[model samples]
Target: MAEPTDTAKTEQVLTEGNEAGVPRRDEERLKKWFIGSIDQGTTSTRFLIFDGTGTPIASHQLEFKQIYLHSGWIDHDPVEIVQTVETCIEEATKEFTKQGHSTSDIKAIGLSTQRETTVLWDIETGDLLHNAIAWPDTRTHAIVHELKNRKGADKLQDICGLPLSTYPSSVKLIWMLRNVDKVKKAYDEGRLAFGTIDTWLLFNLNGKERKLHVTDVTNASRTMFVNLHKLEYDSTVLDFFQLDPQKLKLPKIVPCSDPNAFGSMASGPLKGVKITGCLGDQSAALVGQLGFSPGMAKNTYGTGCFLLYNVGEKPVISHHGLLATVGYHFGGQRKPVYALEGSIAVAGSAVQFLRNNFKFIEASPDINDLAATVKDNGGCVFVTAFSGLFAPYWIDDAKGTIFGITQFTERGHIARATMEATCFQTKAILDAMEKDSGHKLAQLAVDGGMSNSDLCMQTQADLIGIPVDRPVMRETTSLGAAIAAGFAVDIWKEFDELKEINKEDRTIFKPQMTTGQSNGMYKRWERAVEMSKGWVDDSDDIPPSS
Candidate 1:
């Protein structure tokens, strides 16, 4: 008889077990199992359904309203966020089932959300007390200033691995307690419930019958309430913030990937599906990129840009201004891995600015085509500090400024400058990460909305002088969540198995600019960044409404 062909072998592996003698039951489970990921981001919420091999089979995305109450104040409706998530899950799962698959095939779900966005509600009635405070909102700037000057405030970094800033949930929560009457009333009555987006979604998804209030370590780490060393809420920090344990209803911090911690969906097309994973959006992107070991790093360019450099099991406090965060904890016997993260407050939002503020283009994708029209930035440099600079600089005083513009400048020049601004900031963050981690990045695994721009990726490669690897599936944020959920259900038994999935046909952008040229451009960018600072010297510039 002729030897079996490759197709026959593949068919045999699909129908029967391979030479490893895997049981038929296991094979059938593997064949039918599907994982779902809810990627709740700053500007949008998306749900993606993936098979056992990590390939997204069905997905749905909804762009929700971003409420900007004031210049630097941002908020989102808590109810809207929850409703949008439910809608996405229902729609995506419907498509999955419509494709001849059963809802039972979706064995597990994972959640990835924008970290540090705080929501407060009533524990008994589940009524949202106020709109969700977005991470980028600077309403807590005064509170942060007060905390910074208070006694023992300086020691917060040592305890929580984070400095007092407007970015964390602790500060946002404090702001709400002091400003919002409803929140204060709830706190006084011992009914105030506090959580990030993940916690809020989990609570609502589990339904009114049995509300589950919990958060993953990755999301909890950004809140400034959890101690990096202890992996739980620290009493000392709580004392410093003057938050009484008797009054506050904080969620329990659980492992990033757990089958039981995040409860099943109470209703929807994916009703009763187990939630096995929860991660901050950036951390989820890192896991989705399979950056499981030390020295591996990934950049996610969503509403903002975040670079996470994995530093292995132990947390390394950044002496270089980066935030130390829990990367992910795969529940079982494994320890949680830590990472050094650098956040850029603006990335794709700069592109959105062009569309919404400047009307430079009708849509975001038009930016790439328009930007490519110009050979370079045309002697223009844009400092995209719309909500101030984050990471190494931390110049909250800076405002968005475009310098080097002349009468000859065109829209293309501004577009190019906008793209370059993000690239320059990313390079700055990478430099800080290198200094902090003592490891040089050979390549960067990138994903998110802005990463879709080949022009932007090429610019990033040229500026950083490293290969930029982008996978065919640019939705790694959702993919990461799916991977975590799949891990819990044994759809993916080991990390080594993920290496074979989603590994084919990657796009690599190589550096094309000379070192001297790149350096010259970056120096000009630095000067522009410096010039943009102190633009808002008057305290009145940021009104009390924020």
Candidate 2:
């Protein structure tokens, strides 16, 4: 099998052409040696080199600086993200040289990034107007709340398959235009440039001279501005916020993984290598974990816990709080498959709060061991609302609240309960997915940093009453990029042929808790969630951007 490339699915044909869809150079000059997977996330950026089988031959990673301008504000320097990505590629290629291989084998590259973070800048100057406003930033909560009351707010959920919340890009972009100095003035002057992370990186990576401005279908769907059916930026949504479609620059929506959508790296050691695949972090993790068929599911434990269940073809408008999302437009599927996703705002970061905020634990892993020390929760259950609840119950007003603290409750119990908080939310999401899709989860394919925990996996299994499968390689997010990159360059002919590439020792946790125990514990979790709503007052009276 061959490797995956950085091309979008739209660019996967054996034939090649330039941005104008015309052949500017020899199509055969496009190297077919390596595919680079650039995994850009909330905290860090990485560059991975892969072969035909979706295996990582070499990789490098670097964490970037995060700026919190104000409380509830989260931002990233687009320049920093691009530079770190370059450094990662350089470092990885240096390591590759140490392994007695030249960087020449690199064929294509794929990118999976933190979704909904927006970057505004001058199309000519190549300078960012402001830091990237992350999806979780609460600075826009004011606008979110204001819109929640308006008549169109109720209709937004049906059209976009997403609730009118701070998590999406539409509101965040609106907030930037209204609150920021340059963003507002520039938009008024029609000089503003806007893009999600992938678009920003693609423009930076390809060359500032000829802006490579196109967003993959998967990322565009999350922005709320894009019409879910037409897969283009909607004028109605633009008008709802009283914004100018002309000033707010949006990239063309294209397929998820193709070799030529955004050409290869132009400045890195792998400069000539073409990028062929791109996806948001969670979507890439799904594809990387090989959730190819319908009924396939995975829960990525990141800053937030995102649970996705693949539902094949044509979007199923989710009745529940879950978002109807594109599984992938591999540019090969009969039609793009969709997913019912339950996104939780808090997951692994809850443990981080215990370490940095509460000073309860010395390190992150200590929480896990401390959790395992306690046989059970000791009647303590934690509702991780550090960022409020998501999916099934879109309680934007909730804050992190720990409940049922008793005389016997200790750090160990809290630790276990903290981990269980993730599991419980995950179970709720899976339950919601099952309800909406009418498909009970047979098993869960797990990846990401937290899935390494045997205790957490077992807890997830017990709560969800399904088998939890932890892949051998936790880097499935990057590997998925590799897979798409390889597929585009004809290194791998089909998905099944590449299945054995990342095979490793597996861990499977089967449901052990009895139905009665599961029910009673879940009921307690429900009560805890109800109590959590008062943290901010979920009543519609809360101020927008509150």
Candidate 3:
């Protein structure tokens, strides 16, 4: 949507405030009260505007270029990620202002970013020392290998509830320190500032002023620096990487809401807005889904896959390879909740690979139609190891593989198998989640791009042998961030008020596939995953077949 003419905006903003259908405080203030959400994801950037009840009124989205200078090296132009993000925030709010709302309505801004993407910038100049090394970047593979080589590899799982894998930010930070010329210079000059996309945006968003750098607990855990128990950077972990603590400004790790944890939005269509909430994308999606109670869980199928199970009040370190992360930490809730997280590195992006690379399908949803052509996969199984397996199997070097192919295995069969890959991986992660939490996931609340496909939802429910719930609104990540900001700005009095927000407009898929078929299909998936093991590529090549 384009900007409204000045007169039109004046009339619309006023008209919306005058609606008699509801009783909103300070109709004049409500006219100016909007929430801004900046959602930075693996492949794209999006900005959304929300009214008080957790619905997106307007949004703008853009996809950025991913750089793969080497087979394992994935990067993003830091400048592009920064600039595009700001532009989207402006554009989305412009749309809202045009349609009976005003920029001033945005009382607070919340942030949700792709976890584990590392950035290093100069404090003095505020310039990126290197491209934003993305979460999928594999340049840290060797660093993880070296860390594990030291005698204490097994001890990390107990401390962090995670194994040595390239997915974590610790190895990524170390790789930059040892390899990047600019990072070394900054370190020596006492000008180094390290952060994920969150810190990068925070610095830039605050006009590079006061260096108001911080990360929510959810993002911090992805970096190996944070001691899960203390919520501070681990001295031993920092020493292991040989990073100078004094030289770099460690962002104050804070909860997701209210005054202490934040700074205000300096400029945009929503200029002068006080900024207050932050979460890594997946965690925000959980909050958006309103999975506040224990036993409630959500799985988002976006560029990658993430499952978060709400474990109330205290952290539950996983015995399995699953990660222990902060579920939500709002000012309204005195006690913080925890989650057992399982990440699979490929999901909707797997279909994008087929559509863009091999020319298997022109439109993504066509894969859904084509896959449904057959009742089941024709003994074909696609193992999506694009960035290697995550959770349960943290194989850094493993690449993609496909097995059980025969002459009967047509494109339709392969397409069906690809979709099944996501379902199968979710099942594996869910099994581990249940094992570690000792709490069975009853019905999974799901959102994101792939959840739009009915077939995929049924497949996910059937494979896991549980019902899958899909909400009317697909963009839960943004909604989650909005919830945090709302709490910070006092748009709602308490966390319990959020429960009244309707989710009854949902579709629930129940398991119909017999247990034998589900187990038998899953066993084939296991074998395919086994074949994908130890398949690493050191040279530049196409990302492994999804």
Candidate 4:
């Protein structure tokens, strides 16, 4: 027999791996396989391309408009979000191809989206019925209050693992159903399609040509509709909300890492690529940080701060005001892992307030430099409750407060206080996680926009009295989706193999302040937070439907 040619050898290697159902880890094979991730965040939409080793090769990010129609309300155009995703994919893939990589090498795509942002659209035409209700929007406060007063409302936490709050998609969906005539009409006619950001993106990306509407377990967990134990929409909860599933077209809930649920991209640069994975942003951050094992925890500091502590298989319902949520579920025989989460609604957004609202800094990063100029907060403590405090505190009536401000205070002092506010909230959440999970975090894996600030991270370490690990990538949200996608396609055969990737150089911020000093500062922060409560008088405010 004649020796096989080079082309024949390559074909045999690729075909044999598929036929044998084994992962190909050869360097040559790895060089030809790439994974893509769409990180649809609150402030921006990003498309990232990564090689098998979890290194980002190319990325494109676009900041979409944040619509504030009224005070304490936030919305986003669903159509614009879809367009941004397509634009990012096209631009990023072009850069990837420009860097001597084949667009065909992009094997699969994963999605990490901002969770709980409600989107309603026409089932047939796919036209958005209303602006996507942002997770931070407080328009649903009255509805949340009314729901809380109902009989069986307190039991909601037992079933959904979430308290009645405007932060959830269910409340937002309810608001749309009551306020938007188009949404109500569609629901009455059985033509309304409801989903979180991930489902909306998946539906639009898969196009109207193929009927695809599904949300991952992590995203579904945030809607206050799914039962934590059953991992499906609860009938009792839906009935309590007066929502009949038969009337509204809700997305099907799927696994976080699935080979086929998400469907393929019908258009854009990644037209033929299979979408194999999907996660909410926080869960994606956890996956990106490789927090797969029990007792591992990660904190993502984006527009908001989310700390997820992995609690193994069985869910531990939080008695400490933390949330019990599905961390990630890689389908097919793998059991789902649970997490105790503490969510802080304002983190990087506080910095944005400083830049845009206060004009204390010209840019977001400049707050760090300015903050470094101050030796201390000069007795100032900012509660940062611009959108109400979340997590252990759960004080929705609180407004942003700046305490101990005197003639001696300057922008630097306030900046320092601003940074400290997030650290204090993180420390509060960490304390709650430990209480709920019974696992004291030895160290925290950190990622996202605010984690880039060395001062902020060091402060976090000091406050928590533990090490803070920040990966060099800082884009772990995207990396996490890429990791999930890669896993589904057999590019990454096992979780053990992931340990070898993205482990080169990481920045570790160790505790520097004494325990007593840290405790004292936190105590002062608590006092400031207490003082900020009850500032909002909701009685005079009109209802969302009005």
TM-scores of the candidates are 0.94, 0.90, 0.91, 0.94
Q: Rate the local accuracy (lDDT) of all candidates.
A: 0.88, 0.79, 0.81, 0.88
Better of 2 and 3 by lDDT: 3
What TM value does model 3 have? Answer: 0.91
The residue ranges of model 3 lying beyond 4 angstroms of the native Cα positions read 1-33, 537-546
Across 217-302, the per-residue lDDT of candidate 4 in tens digits comes to 99999999999999999999999999989989988998988778899999877887889999999999998999989999999999
RMSD of every prediction: 4.7, 6.3, 5.7, 3.5
lDDT of 1 by residue, 377-482 (tens): 9999999887778887877778899999899999999999999888999999999988987778999999988999999999999999999999998888888998
Clash count, predicted structure 1: 0
Give the top-scoring candidate (lDDT). 4
RMSD of 4: 3.5
- Candidate 3, lDDT over the whole model: 0.81
Name the runs in model 1 displaced over 4 angstroms: 1-31, 542-546
Q: Candidate 4: TM-score? A: 0.94
Q: Among all windows of ten consecutive residues in candidate 4, which has the lowest summed lDDT?
A: 6-15
Off by over 4 Å in 2: 1-33, 332-334, 537-546
After best superposition, candidate 1 residue 152: deviation in angstroms? 1.7
